[model samples]
Target: MTLWLSSGLIFTFAAIALILYKWWDMQCIGVTPVRTLVFIAILFTSGLDVGLIMFPLTEFGGYGNVSDNPEYGFANPLAIEFGFWAFLIWGFYFLTCFYFAIIEPRVQFFEIPVVKFINNVVIIGTCAFTAYLLLANLPWYLPELSSDDGVVPAFYAIVFLSIALAVYSSSKIKYVRILSVGSSLLFIALIVGMWFRAFVLGQGSPADFFGTASMLGEYFGNLNKF
Candidate 1:
């Protein structure tokens, strides 16, 4: 698995470099070309998932336990978390976006009935898995909404409602644009609110914020090790 991961990382980086060299001046006109801001909003919202919200809270302690997970010893837990979510990992998205935008138009592999069916199946399966993850984690995050045996009916209802809303939003391109932009704005507001509550309203100090921010430097310093 490590060898495969390493190969993929190398290939992604090489491909990114090749794309930059060859198509640096070329415009990536997709099948449906929207404005740059809309394109960015779409990618930003699509790139995020339940894992981005839940992973750090669950895995921070595990990453910090370098005695058992010596592979993480090269950097701090915060660095490890950031590395997992950012940097080279984004290259995979870049390659996928580039392929769909540039190469797929020419090859039309996904236009085939079998390939389209398989792609839709994979996408739906991924959405279901994401919902399952949310349901599984909700019991721990909101125990009041769950019973001792397992997830409660309310939790299931919430998940179903969420899936329904997502499907409805995806029914039209205009809905998708509105949702993507709205969600992006809401996320920004959420971050600002949290920061205000923490530093301005709460007892958090600049030193505390800076000290935590400094931990991310370890990731940059040990990029090769990662």
Candidate 2:
């Protein structure tokens, strides 16, 4: 069990490092200021969700054997806690697509160099993320992902497929013509990141500044609801 946990943790770390490295490269080359902000924002929210999930898991005990005792069981507490985390993490992802793929095209009708650059980054990342599912641990098998908690992934896949179709659509639709392919690629990258951090890491990764804030917000937000 310890070995399994360690392996999962390492997978997450490697995935995150790879992602950050890619983002850093983008930053170094001045890919786009907006793109940088988008990645940073997502990373920050992810950190917080993971931290909140960890606090209870660690405090109760390391993820070991499953038990029925309410005091010892991780399922109930973790489910309740991580559900919100998943909600927020996925909420942002969905909103990103809604704004970028749907709304922006209708409203802006133009892409600046930086915005276009960011769009490319998003596309490439999405492609990589989808590839990871096929080669990595295969998160597609997880039942949880198809359930209520999986709404974000489902929507992500939907948005991604839409982007793919948009790529092949009539060229006169300026936004679709310009961004479809890039959006699809970014969707794949994000999926890969999700697989790495959620399934591989299992929410035990270290905290970052943004992640800390997310954790606090969710923890308190949930508390207030109750």
Candidate 3:
């Protein structure tokens, strides 16, 4: 199988697993489908993106050729994979932020309700700022912060809106609160990975950090050969 296809398979499995986990947990706790579906969607997307990127690199030998012949570790269009993965990472980040801001306090996961509310608000705001750094400008900002030129901005905005709505609608569920915080931490980790990878690649800012972490990169190479 092509590298992109293999990665897609991984993403598919991860998405399914996340959905099932969220549904099962919420069902046991008496949370209805409405509540669980939102969480499932958010997590599934995260897994999907993770699959899209990692599978391509690890399986396909992510790289491209500038000349007629390509060499291993050679730089090519695959560099764009970094940006694509970063975009997905930010998508999850905002989703987590909104969960914390609006959902966590409602769920009563935090002993201090006020603390949960405040933390959620802070996380959401920070996500917004980080997203700007990642999407609007890259090479000028940071390498890992770069994103795919077309879809990144739109996807980020959509995820942000969805999370905001979820937080606003269910501001009083205990389990929601716990999940929100956990999701936020995960999102933060994703961002850190992108940033660190950029630095490793010698990109001064997160802006220049594009590499194969997406199925698209692998496909791009295969297409070139054809």
Candidate 4:
């Protein structure tokens, strides 16, 4: 994982510097899915302090058990893990977003919400909370936060959405059915497509996950050697 864990980080850190340079000169920026994905990917790579309460239990159950350097005597191995997971992964991205929010022109993404009852309030709230786990993981030095706080809410959102889906499927209400069924099918299609491409086509293992760097690095490795 040298190319992935070490070299890739160096590449992204340089890329972030390039983006910051471009942002400085361009004065106008376009938001794209790729950019956002890259940005979030960086945060997930670098930051971790905010993730103290984001999981049900320890993120790395046994990865951090062995000491990296016993002679040096580091305090917590998990904080070191967070250094990779949350800080390196998403920290710069969050700061960049903050910089954009303050410096750039913005669009209003809001509409009238007079009829809150008519919307996916529970779904939206739960999803937002899930994302907040990443943000909270940003601080990286938070004293002590319960991982259950984020996990429980995320579980609630899943349960609520599941129930809503169950009801929708059973009733098959005209409008709801269109969206629910279509989205469900679309989601399944995407999952199947990616799964086939990743594991079957690429012959990747559990480690062969996430980022263009990983995909590109594994091109020859994932092939039929035998």
What's every prediction's RMSD, in angstroms? Answer: 2.4, 16.8, 16.2, 20.3
Give the per-residue lDDT of model 4 (tens digit) for 1-226.
5546566557777867766676655533344323443434433422232353345134444434556444212324344444434434473664556455544435322233644443468656755675555445433423243364444354446446755664565463343435444554554687788788988888775565654334333323322210
Task: Candidate 2: list runs displaced more than 4 Å.
Answer: 1-86, 101-103, 106-110, 138-226
* lDDT (Cα atoms) of all candidates against the true structure: 0.85, 0.48, 0.52, 0.47
- Predicted structure 1, TM vs. truth: 0.86
Worst 10 residues of 4 by lDDT: 217-226
lDDT of 3 by residue, 89-164 (tens): 5545554554454566588666577977887898789657645543443333344544556445555665577557
For candidate 4, give the lDDT: 0.47
Q: Which is the leading candidate under lDDT? A: 1
Candidate 2, residue 189: lDDT: 82
Ranking by TM-score: 1, 4, 2, 3
Which candidate gets the maximum TM-score versus the true structure? Answer: 1
- Identify the superior model by lDDT, candidate 1 or candidate 2: 1
Candidate number with the higher lDDT (2 or 3): 3
Model 4 misplaced regions, further than 4 Å: 25-52, 60-75, 91-158, 161-226
Q: Against the true structure, candidate 2 has what lDDT?
A: 0.48
TM-score of each: 0.86, 0.28, 0.26, 0.29
